[model samples]
Target: MTIRVLIVDDSKTMQAVLRARLSREADIEVVATAGNAAEARQLMRELDPDVVTLDIEMPGMNGLDFLEKIMRLRPTPVIVVSSAAQAGTESAARALALGAVDCYAKADRFGAMGTEDNGKLASLIRQAAQIRFDQRAPSIPKVSVKTQKSIGGDTRLIAIGSSTGGVEALQILLRDFPADCPPTMIVQHINVNFAAAVARRLDSICKAKVLLAEPDMPIRRGQVYFAPGGDRHMMLGGTENWFVKLRQGDLVSGHRPSVDALFRSIAPKIRGHVVGVLMTGMGSDGARGLLEMAQAGATTIAQNEASCTVFGMPRAAIELGAAGVVAPLDRIAEHALSRAA
Candidate 1:
């Protein structure tokens, strides 16, 4: 089946460029283009495109506001396409929090354009079209937390991995934890430009300190580390207390920051002291690694289908018999705390 797409950008040049880029794929059809949110709303009603590629800095109604409206009214899968500049980073992050399924950086400005962009764009379109749209619910503002308790001295480590719809899923799961939550490491599949923005956004919503993980950095309690670099897999290293270690390796299961790679490494290193959680995301990047963690006696949990944005990763883990318990996104934090407690 052809994947229908709608391009929503204020710039006529950008719309043309995106159309040209996406046109190369035989399975993709650019059904319509809208210069602003008002036009987008009308086309959305008329064209009924399978997916939408949205730009953040549109005139009049901005992308974030429009996205919020779409999530509330239409509930379609959206891929945020934005500039890599600082302001674009902030807006793109907000769009993701508002319920965009994925995000991509525009390639023309960087002067490193390639077929890879076309391939990725096409893949995103196909993936978005397959997403169960009505399953999406409106995003609620993050709740405020009064105080956070640091993980107890006996708590060893926390590891997580996600892809596809993971950006919003991770935010919701992390928002409820106390500031002193376990020393957590996350491997979220995302483009390089958006990784920092994701970390910053999570830091604002969660009580625990959140920052992009760097090689050789010491892991500290009450801090959460994210793999900022997407081309490498993040692992734990060091003698006294394991810290973040980034390494370039073959793409295992089609992802660089493969959840399996991180979880497999943590299984033997942290062993019984670790808590491993697999949230909503597409594909099976973390299934086998989660199983390895379960074998090593670490507590393993999968987000149940009811709360998952995409049920692929968690379902794969459950099928592999990796998860010790399958709980909804709202209950994951309390469950993790219980294991650590």
Candidate 2:
């Protein structure tokens, strides 16, 4: 099937560059282009594209506002394109929180561009086109309070891993957490530019205090730790009273702050004191690590297929017999809280 895409950017050069790069893919077709949000909205209706390549810094109706509108009205997958800089990162991350499906950071103007970068963009667009868009307010099944599982001990820690549709998925899951929830740590595959913004955004909405994890930062209850975006891996470490540590290393599971890295790091120390929750993502990064958690007697919960934006990671864990329980997005928080409490 042809993946029709609409390009929205104020800069004619970038728009042409994006269109040219994307057109190299056999299945992708650039149907239309727009210079701003108003033009983009009109083209979206006229072209009815499968996906959108959005620029965050457009004049008159910025990408973030436009993204929210698209999600509410049309609901197609959107890939945000921004510069590989700190300012660009904040806008892109905000776009994700507002419902963008993916983000791509461009190389600096003088930096040499490569085929691999273009290839990754095409791959993300294709994967997004294949996915069925998951809305925020779907028909929720009636949750039975009696169905809640009782975990035995005081929940010492919680670890979560996600990617792709994670921004919304994590928000949905974390909104249910109590103010005094367990010391939670998360590894969500996001661009380094927007990692801190994402944590701050979540901190504003969530009951728990969410902050980007710093090297040697001690972990404690009621505060949620987030892995920063970059070439470094965020892992759980420290012997007595755990702390988050960042390591510079080769990518694991195709990501620096990989779900696998987080899970593998926490595996040795969990020992029934932690709850591991692997949510919606497009890869098998956290599968093996979740198995380690389960083997270590920690309660492991995988988001069920019915409620997943993409079931790859959760399905991987379930197939590996790593998940102790499978729950929908809505019930995951409840289950995790029950297990932890």
Candidate 3:
């Protein structure tokens, strides 16, 4: 099936470059191109493309504002094409939080001529086109009192691993966690800037304090530490009582902040005193680690396929016999809380 794409950029040259790069992929068809948000909206209604390539900087209506509107009105998978500057990173991070599917940094030299390096652009377009879009409307699930509970003495930690659609799924799960929740560590497959933003966003939503994980930091209860992506693996270290380690290591399973790394560490360190949750993501990044946790007698839960944006990670865990339970997204928080209690 052809993946229909709409390109929205202020630069005519960028539009041409993107069109040319994507045209090489037989599965991708550039249905329309818009130079601005207004034109993009009009074309969106007319063309109804499967995906959109959006530029961060634009006149009249910026990409961020347009992204918000698109998510609220007509949800479509959006790949942000941004520069490599600091400002670009910040904007791209915000775009991810606003529900952009993915982001690609344009080549540094491309800024001078307003043209992209076709090679890199084509690679990104291929990846973006393969991403499965979640069209579910945004609505906060009603908070249930039954879903919130205190952690048990045996359940000393909560570890979560996710990728792809994990950003939105994590937001929903974290928002429901209580202030006194167990010490939680998350390994989300995402860009570096977006990882920090995700932690901050979770901090705002959940009562628990959320911060990016640092090397040799003490693991404190009721706090959440997020693993930052950029060629590093978050591990467990320090003394048994206050131990937590975030170390830089080789990429495992093609991911730096791999869920497998985190889960394996927890299995040997925390053992039976942990609760593991695997959420929606595109790949099998967490399956092996989750199995380690399960073998260690830790409680492991996989998000049900019906609620997952992409069932790859969780499905792998289930197939491996690593999951103790497979629950819907809305029920995952409650399940974790219950195990803790």
Candidate 4:
């Protein structure tokens, strides 16, 4: 099926470049091009495109403001396409929080749009087109932290894997965690460039200290270690004295910093002392490893379909008997903590 797309950017040159790139993809068609939020809104009312490519730095109503409006009213799938996203800036992370389905790093104003990323952007467009949005509140209300407490002795570590809709999911999940939560490890599939910004964004919101994992960094209570994106897979090291270890490797289950690698690594060493959570994502990256964790007697949880933006990862785990429990997104934090407690 053809995926109709709307291009919204202040620059005519960027519009042309995006149009040209998308034109090469037979299944993708640029239905409309708008220079600013006003024109974009008008086209949205008329075309109802399957996907939108939005530039954050637009005139008048900014891309973020317009994106919030779209999500609140029409609820359409939107991809933030901007140099701001490419730079792994705070604006890019904010776009995701505001309900953008994905972010595509585009060439800067003075830079040339490279040929290598054409097909990649097309792939993202195809994926975004398949998403269905509902007219609901754009943000999840932060959970009250007063009820939370420190982790139980049985739960030595908390490891989480997510992709696609993970940013928002993690935000909601972590907010409910106590200030002195267990040593938490997270692998959220993302653009390598955007990893730091995402970590920073999460740190600002959560009670626990959220940090990007560094090689050989010791696991500690009250901290959440986020895997660094790129060519290395983040794994657990030192059985009794656990630390984050980044290993250079080819893609495992189609991701470099794979969820499977992280889950599998922790399974044997920690055994029943771990709590594994596989949240909203596309594809089955964490299924097998989650099974391994379950087999090792670790408490394993999967996010249920009702709350997942895309239920692919969790569904795969559920089918494989990997998940010890399947829970809705809202209840996951409480449930996981209960298991740990």
Tell me each candidate's TM-score. Answer: 0.93, 0.89, 0.87, 0.94
lDDT (Cα atoms) of all candidates against the true structure: 0.83, 0.83, 0.80, 0.85
Q: State the displacement of the C-alpha of residue 52, model 4, in Å, after optimal TM-score superposition.
A: 0.7
Query: For residues 200-224, what per-residue lDDT tens digits would candidate 1 score against the true structure?
Result: 9989988889988888888887899
- Write model 3 residue lDDT over 139-258, tens digit each, in one string: 355565876644464568899999866777888888778888888999998877466666777787788899888877788888899998887898777547655677778889778889
Name every residue pair that clashes in candidate 1: 148-179, 150-180
Kindly report which residue pairs in candidate 2 clash with one another.
192-229
lDDT of 4 by residue, 197-277 (tens): 889999988889999999999999999999988899999999789999999999999998999999999888964568899
Superposed model 1: Cα runs more than 4 Å off: 112-118, 136-153
**RMSD to the native, candidate 3?**
2.9
What number of clashing residue pairs does each candidate have, in the order they appear? 2, 1, 1, 0
Instruction: Name the weakest run of 10 consecutive residues (lDDT summed) in model 4.
Output: 133-142
Better of 2 and 3 by lDDT: 2
What are the candidates' C-alpha RMSDs? 2.5, 3.3, 2.9, 2.3
RMSD of 1: 2.5
Q: After superposition, how far is residue 302 of candidate 3 from its true place, in Å?
A: 0.9
Candidate 1 whole-model C-alpha lDDT, 0 to 1: 0.83
- Model 4 per-residue lDDT at 319: 99
Please give the TM-score that candidate 1 achieves against the real structure: 0.93
